[model samples]
Target: MTGDVGRAIGFAVVGALALLAPLLEGRVDDRVAAVGTVAPFVVVAAVAYLSTSGPLFELFARPGDREEGRLYGLASFSLGIAGLAVIYVAFEFPVSAFLVAVFALTVGNLGQELTARYTPDPAVGTSAFAVLGTIGAVCAMLLAGVLGASVPALPLAVFVAASGALLGALIRSVLFVRDDSLVVLSVGLVVWFFLELGLAPTLRRVGIGIALTAALGYVAYGLGTASVTGMLTGVLLALFTVVLGGFGWFVLLVTFFGLGGLASKYRYDEKLDRGIAQENEGARGGGNVLANSAVALVAVVAFAVSGHVGVPSAVFRFAFAGAVAAALADTFSSEFGGLFDTPRLITTLRPVAPGTDGAVTWQGVVAGLVGSAIIGGLSGVFFGLNAPGVLLVVFAGVVGMTVDSLLGATLEGDYLGNQGVNLLATLSAGLVAGLAALWL
Candidate 1:
């Protein structure tokens, strides 16, 4: 236990120094600063191997395992140097420099943790250490910014710290089952780095929006409307919206999910009695959410990134609209369509079971059309598409719905599953919308 405490302290101290070196670049000679920046990480790698009681220290350690350890060590060293380079390049922007430094340290530590054969003593878990270490490192970063020629923005600092803490705690909680403390810290750091780099100025604006979305997702999980994995997936989807499309897109996504969830429960008892209800008693999982929203999210990202590439931004908007509309159409058809007793096979006019894969009913078709129309109208309002654009979106959604049924009947349960059918349907809708935008 005493040895464990000592090791933990040593790890924390080394991490703090590594994080602080970037802040000291202005105060020391260039060569001295460079050495200081790289030394801590090298030491960490050596300690990770030498401190372990496992075969890690045996010069004759299993050849394969020894090579792996060497690779991890090299990776840690390279990442440390790369991190220093990013911080140096972004030195003019204190916030960017600090964030990059945090990211570098995270990667190095994670590499070290994964490569090491021995688990650290249980005196302190990696998660708690990460939270404390990150807080300290961030504080050092802020101090460095203050002492340097340029000052860090107060709002940015506060945002980084708060976000880091929240992400740390969330990651630790999620990875508790694995009990690998460093892995948890590394995952959280990487995620934060992505958000900070991707969102930046917008992150400050949409922080509250993301928080609200996360809270609602958790509440839904609590209410048994979504599984725990589903809730996490929803949070990721919400973050993607904030980063890729801002508040309007997030609102549309939430509206679709909320309404779809409610509709799923409307005739639950009847569907259950008919033995055609959704699995997990209507609670959606990560896979289900991903199946429905992945294409839309991809469209939003493409639109956001294409702004500077001279791509007509409107084309991407249409793609986004079509994908969302298709998802809504498919969801409504499945949830509400199952409640009707008049379902028939789309391939043939023969009556089928209520929840038959290729089944369609007039009531369900109308419900899907209504769902698609709602998305189309919202796309017009949010994306500024004219009447022609709106109609194109609606038409594309209906096409996707038809494609989904055709695919379900022919491919589903034999060659393709539900997720595959949904993906193809949404892809078809997005392509059709893109084509319509070109022609009209």
Candidate 2:
């Protein structure tokens, strides 16, 4: 009953916006383009509302009528509308009016809800909707910056937006938009890229990279519930990763991890039961934790007179590059594994069970190896690490995978689960790979 009422209200609001669009578009003056500018929001809102309950809704809606999905759409509508209000107040741009309207539209789309509606259980829907709303909001901000009539921020905005969009699309493809994580990633990367370019003058190069990437990450995690929390998280992470590390490696890491996380999270609802939407809960986040921790541990140990030891520059580069390769391999292996494998246990080559913890198939192993190889090869080109360094990464990746599986199979299995274990394993792999690249 509440759902129906909410939907009705949404419909009404969208309808009102639609009606107002033409009036504003045609009647409003050029200086503001307020009326016309806002029309897109109305269009977006109408599309969103209709999307939830209209023609395409049936195609996408889950069986048995999902109230949560509908409610999420409403929530998104409200949030988007609110975001528009913020933009309007902050910038006083005429386009702010339209921003409101488009936000409403995206709210209606509830891409997150659309993706989650089919799940038998609503638990996943909660996370998915939250993820979608955040991604959508970030995208909205970028869109505003890029499309704004003002000429000054245009180039920077466009570049960041374009980079973000390209990265987002790439992430969407790699993870295949079935999950909410891609939305999270798309939003984060785009925002970071935009700010990195736009605020280059105001913020330190490293600071901008750190801040923007952090912002992106926080938003991606659905940590936007408390804007400060997510932003801070992203900031700290970026500072440690991208800001401290060189762009060549940091950018790729962000790109890979951001996309991989998104891809790993969320899936087509109906497909959830069939394993179509299923992901390794264990592997989902472990690598990042490990990666960050390793860096931190190294920093701490080297905190005193770090310059004296003179850690080989190549070692740092190799470690960073290796981390990137390991992450890529992990994503590819997990993403494509189900498609081609018999799901053999990592311990023995024999087939065990599909979705088994620590399971590794020939298909997955080979694919992971390839993924690492690609990253290693790229590292060679970017850092001039040489064939030996590249080979070390590959070897390290294999070891990493083994470490990851071992963690999953043993100590990590006890409490941390796959997510924690994988993170650790990857970090270990990256660090080891780095060391190997540096020495051998």
Candidate 3:
């Protein structure tokens, strides 16, 4: 009975957090409000009840689950209060308010994790995070009830309850079970903002651009081949900017995508580790002509479509094509360098053994050049560039690859985590490409 009582209190706290936080952000309204209010409290109650049942708790949350639950609830409630305060101070309604709301919710959620020290179990952790979010929503509404007596209190209260219940039970299914996929989705969301808001009006052009880049991922993950999700992300970003009247965006996109492509493809056959060792880890191989060819093919398609089809039609096709080209070129050089019988130091043509970082092989060099030519040609086709513009993009890719190698050999590893390295490299390549476009 004591255990039951503690569990109930814990659940009530979680419910409070979930219900108030989202509403304070103005994300909750009449429809979403209902589920939001009632769900959190009910979920807390359900989880609490299960905690007192030994087998049930063990099956769901493991040993110390009950204690962990209590800590999580309390932390959520406390943080939610803090978040509400922050929201009140941050800014006016709509955008600023939304950000503040999200900010508070995010902070409170992080606080719960810090306070509880719960292990990273996707099923348990994510659900708990969602519940923590609910607490923030509830708290916000409660504050409103106290201060702005004009606000309807019942709706806010009920919304908190329902959202908590649904989120508590369904979070595992919605986000936790496929954690890696969730990360990927999160990355996409982040990328979307970079393209849409950071760049400009090009957001409308994003549909095709996103589809095309995502297709590259599908080819790699779904079809069992290498891919460059990074390049795709970069290209989509730049193209979105370009469409929206962004100046000098093209250079950054091309240079970075080019460099990222080269870096990413180094271990074409290996799994995406993204761990620490990836700087110089994995087996290498020969260049893939088929892959490089595809790169060129995509680049050409994009350039032609963008120049001729108008920004709307061309944006997606061109961006996607560029991404494909970058992916192919990068993968070809990286993998091929490993298989070269006589690798040479990229800094000096002196012979070095395969597997040496920053080493270039004859086959890899050839593959990189071919990749640039094809992708650049595609750009030419779209932009209707004379020989000079076409040559410039190709030159950018070739030079960008070398610069990428230099960065890889020296500075990039220190600043960027595995993923950050990829982003920086792509940015560099795109910058170079844009400059070349201007000059030639």
Candidate 4:
């Protein structure tokens, strides 16, 4: 048999054994069960170490990388065990849920390898693997429910499958990391996180989330506003926003995306002549999507999990808007800054060339304010934010925009890229709004 197949079969056998923990909960400590699940990986690592240049080494290692595969493979096991431990230990979720997560996730990996081998097209293989993995995960979750775990089977199944598909794709395609260890950690962490938060999306909510995200993502991809990977990442974020944050949050996110696309497309020729066009004619790639929206995604997710953090739900809601507001503000500040006025350095107040980093214009600042006010007004209507809250959102947005400028003028060109600056600025805005919600 192939080494890959052999390794997968090994995982299947171990995963099956580990998943019995829930059934044995009355008699065995779950922690002990976790250790037992991890123990095999240690044994594998030892074999990889001692069996260098032998058949066992070949079994543990992928071609070309040889022994290095063992490192990633062990790391994958460690991360998976740790993520499951967090769910079952720190949060004290159903041991069955934890064990099932372990089983379902690795099973999906095994399934992926098996399915990918015969598929000729890489794209088809990926899609098939994701579908098969989702089916396997759903089956595992539903079966775990029958075994008496307190998990919400169908809802959890949909979420876990969606998350796994996206995360598995992300770690491999976008992040360019070793997926063996990290996919398990990241996907399992997100899955268990939802379980811990008790954020159960009704079937209708899930359906709406899927429908809206798919439609918008397809539109965006068709319009050249986002690349294929960009569309997937955006859709995943939108799904979480729609299901967890509901309409109030989802609308703001959509508005933000719309606003960014419009801003990028406006007067494209003029910006191009100025030698400051958005890179790649404003087509957002995976990195761009992640950099720009990571803050908003975190805000929405935090809002969903806020009840456990002792923060009021409204805080995360406002933070979400503020994050988008800041992102829009930055987009407007950059895209239109040179169209109407002479730019000045934000830090020095000295006249500077248009497109110069950290340069600002009166028109751009006003435009940014308009963007923030739009978000604030929507927040009042959708979020039921009082006047003060609306005002705070605007304030926080301005703060975020300013942070972007300050970073751009000083560190952006020299120390950080535009994406990095955008991330930090948006995060600052989000934190400011969250804090303002708490204090003011």
Q: What is the clash count of model 3?
A: 69
CA shift at 116, candidate 1, in angstroms?
27
How much lDDT does candidate 2 score? 0.47
* C-alpha lDDT score of every prediction, in listed order: 0.63, 0.47, 0.41, 0.71
Best by lDDT: 4
* Per-residue C-alpha lDDT of model 3 across residues 1-440, encoded as one tens digit per residue: 23433443333344345335334334446445444443454454445443454544433342344556433333333343333333332422222122223323343344335434545443234334444544554455456555432232333232322233222223223343213122222322332232223222233343333344334333333332222222223333333334432233343334434444345555444423322122323211112212232333333334434544444433333333334344445545655545557777777767865555566777887877777677667666655656765665666566556655665555555753333433344444554554344343
Q: Write the per-residue lDDT of candidate 2 for residues 241-312, one digit (tens) a residue.
A: 443344555555555546455445534243245464433331233234344344432432232223446775
**Clashes in candidate 2: how many?**
20
Whole-model alpha-carbon lDDT for candidate 1: 0.63
Instruction: Assess candidate 3 and give its lDDT.
Output: 0.41
Query: lDDT of model 3 at residue 406?
Result: 62
Q: Who wins the TM-score comparison?
A: 4
169, model 3: CA deviation in Å?
Answer: 17
TM values, all candidates: 0.69, 0.46, 0.47, 0.77
- Give one digit per residue, the lDDT tens place, for model 4 in 209-232: 767876777677667677667766
Which is better, 1 or 2, measured by TM-score? 1
How much is 320 displaced in model 2, in angstroms? 2.5
Task: Give me candidate 1's TM-score against the actual structure.
Answer: 0.69
Judge candidate 4 at residue 26 and give its lDDT.
Answer: 49
